[model samples]
Target chain A: MLKQYSFEKTAVQTFPDNVSLAMRTENLQVFYGANHAMHDADLGFPKNQITALIGASGSGKSTYLRSLNRMNDNIATVTGKIWYHGVDINEPNVNIYEIRRHIGMVFQRPNPFAKSIRENIVYALKANGIKGKAELEERVETSLKGAALWDEVKDSLDKSALALSGGQQQRLCIARSIAMEPDVLLLDEPCSALDPISTVKVEETLLELQKKYSIIIVTHNMQQAARVSSQCAFFHLGHVMEYTPTATMFSNPQIPVTQDYISGSFG
Target chain B: MEQTNFQLKKQDAQSHEWDARLHRATRATRKDWIGRGISYLCIGVIILVVASMLWFITSKGIATFTQNHVSLWKFLSGTNWAPDQGNIGALPMIVGSFAVTFAAAIVATPFAVGTAIFMTEISPNKGRKVLQPVIELLVGIPSVVYGFIGLAVVVPFMRHLVGGSGFGIISATFVLFVMVLPTITTMTVDSLRAVPRHYKEASLALGATRWQTVSRVILRSATPGILTAVIFGMARAFGEALAVQMVIGNAAIMPKNLISPASTLTSQLTTGIGDTIDGTLPNNALWSLALILLLMSLFFNALVRFIAKRGQLKNGR
Candidate 1:
């Protein structure tokens, strides 16, 4: 057994990069067909900082990320209140779309719309009601640059997005979310499928992106969280074992499970 | 080493001799030949049947069409449909087919797409499992039963609604739309289901609601397959006779309104040929009209196939 970090012990501590809460999950639980997959979890994400949710398979890290935008509302029976900027978005009157528009998500796999590369970025903008071509073009360029994919794809924006490499597609997806100008970005294992080189590119993109948007990333890679994130939340068996600064979580993890997971002894 | 090489060549020669000996013993038997012969003969029979039907219709229809020096303009423009007076203007029947098919598609397409989206995206796991099989059962119901229901129930209701001239294109179309709904729904569901789940997730992750994801991403991605389903439903409606024949008024005059009594090209051919002489020009005209229906359906199918192929290629790249 490992010592658990309680909310009382950690809640009062302020992050080095002092920023307001972009999102905070309270007692989130999820079930699928009578099978409980995620138990009660509470965590707060600081604005303009990368918060990494690290866990083994089935630790409910992905579930926690999904609940940030109520993305699990479609296929699962989810119970929780996720607070965003002082408002509880789980209330019936709170519009999920408006909530999500402020909190964009990038999935594990790169799923570009079966459309042109240019249209991929423009789709989010248009769906949010941007109709002017000139403004859209400018946003597209700005987002591509932010994702670190502008130079490779700027000449072929009109081509189908499926033609791009895997790394490029993932970056394009990031660019798409950025184009929406969301205040927070949730990434679900965004680099699990990429090669090491591609993973490095993605981590670099995340490092640069944290300057503008608060990010909560779900990852199985311990070193990745160590490298890019400022805060780390280590989850084990649906319970959050520890929540601390990345350096402290890596070097002085309070839980044996988190230690075993980080040392590659057992998942 | 040279002596070993010679031994390897000698062994190869011995194996070659054994292979030839086995081949001679395994010669094909009479039964094998008979089976092959029957397979070829069956294929020939299928081809013959299809060709004979085509020839029978074309040989007779071409003569009638040419002998009448058929001004397609007069045939299309003339509204008179009464054959008792020796005037066979088919404009009424053509117009009737269009009205019925259009009305049916208009009502059925939206329902099909909506049900498909629900099945593929919205329903709970249990609800999806239960609803899918129940929806599939709709397609198994016979068209004749549909006709009987329309005749016994729908016509009278329309009679109350329109007050007179109840069994017309509108009533027939209502029944046809319901009948086609199952096919369209199933096929549309298949197409929507085929869209990768990631697309839906991607859209929703962007903060698009379920409806927005369905309308903008899932539906757009599944457009080609859905178009194929609609085209198929339209073809089925165009060729539908059992239900339409019972509900349609069978009046051989032009319909001035949708609720007015009318006849379609198929209804005329079926009832008209039964009362006419076997080899008369009117009988030949039936073949000509049937040929026209065939051409129209073929054109529609080809158009759909072209679009579907283009979509597949685009997706493939």
Candidate 2:
């Protein structure tokens, strides 16, 4: 067996003073039973910018992203402090549901509820106690528009969301998340399942969304990170190996591992 | 000359091998045909048995109107059920069957659904491992045992609490409720488990509480499946003979109240068929009741199929 690298002692990079953070985590660790899946993942997501967490498979990028909103609570035991709005969300007493409302997520797959397009957008809004018909309709249109899907699906608002094409379904999922007006949106490989055209469309949507919400994304595609993200974190063996501006990270990676990974020598 | 002879001998061996391979292929084809024939024969036999049983019931049931000359409408709609006097109204038994089954469903639904939700969604993995098998064991228990329990426990309990004769609609309903609980719970758990984890995650990610996720997203998505379970449970309660017969007073009268004595079609058939002479009007009337039970179950089966198809359509399958 190979020697296990201890990532717990690795130093996390600090952001510049000019950057404003929307959310940050401190000493986050995840364990599935006895297996420590992630170790000491301290990362910061800047406000109104897209931050991409890129790594090879099993590098714990997705796990760290999921912990931001406590989505990992269902299956894994997460430890350490997720700092948001002067509160440690990882505390046992914290209301996970309330936190998740502000930190919405879009999954790797397009999992639109077996509902209509309109209902898909308004479901979270309604769950948050938005009952006005006019307001619900308005949010549906606005959210769909924001995801760049309204022009295609606005005419068929009542049709089942499942009937849409794969790319459209993914956009609908995006719209569904933004409908909640979450301050931060975490996307786990949102375009990894889509075709090239859909991928580009989603990348464009993420770029536009960065103006409104802080976005943290985990992507296996390095080019996607280069395209959409302002800040990029390269994870290796459950540690942030390098955190830098996306342009510099792509053009002149400071670490040899990040350089090797970006050059596709090994993943 | 020796080399040519050897080549000829090798060619002969290759041809022999080819012949053997062809023979084996033919034999395999023959085996496949035999297997297919057996499958078709088994299916045909099942169809034949069911068709014959249906034909027998239909012919015998119609004989009540033809040979005995009992008015068909009166036999169905009339309130009185006297074979010797030949009044023979089946309305009370039909009503009793429906009432008992409805009451059982009402009693069992919440409990079964709650248990199912606990098993699938709420319970931890270890708890699920234990609870699932126990509920399955409940299903394996025989109907007679359930009847005995109803007689020994529920009947007496009702006597003390509800001031009844301890054997009536109330007792029958309680017994059927327990009887159908396992089936409904198992099916509901399966349906709930069939819901994709992604749907729950999506709802939860939207900040919905666990209960809200289950009720709005999981249950709504699983509606068609849950409805199918309810229909299946109702069918079981409707067709159940021994348990309901033992707990229900088996009186030929209409159910006056929840505590009043009543009789279902199955109860009447089981209790009256043995005493009445075969080939009599009363026997044919009992056959008619069996026909009605068969029809009701068939209706329920059709309803299940209809709902399943609707679900498929909604899913765009």
Whole-structure CA lDDT of model 1: 0.83
Question: How well does candidate 1 score on lDDT at residue A23?
Answer: 81
Instruction: Report the lDDT tens digits of candidate 1 across residue range A156-241.
Output: 99999999988889999999999888999999999988899999999999999999999999998888999999999987766676
Give the docking tier of candidate 1. medium
Per-residue CA lDDT of model 1 for B1-317, tens digit only, reads 99999999999999999988877634466678888999999999999998998888778766555765556666666787654554667788888887888889889999988888777777747437887788778788888899899989999999998788588988989998998898889899888889998998788777776777888888898999988888888888888887898889888788887777798888788778787666566665676678878877988789798989988877767
Error of 1 at B175 (Å): 2.4
Chain A accuracy of model 2 expressed as TM-score? 0.95
TM-score of 1: 0.85
Mind giving the per-residue lDDT tens digits that candidate 2 earns over A1-267?
323444443334688878779998988999989988887877888899999999889888999998899998868999988889878999989898899989999999999999999988888888889999999999999999999999998789999999998899999998998998999999999988999999999999999999999999999999899999999998887778788889989998877777778998763
Calculate model 2's interface RMSD in Å.
1.2
The numbered model that scores best in lDDT is 2
- DockQ of each candidate's interface versus the true one? 0.61, 0.76
Q: What interface RMSD do all candidates show, one decimal each? A: 1.2, 1.2
| CA deviation > 4 Å runs, candidate 1 | A1-21, A77-81, A90-93, A132-134, A248-255, B1-45, B66-86, B122-137, B313-317
lDDT accuracy of residue B298 in candidate 1: 85
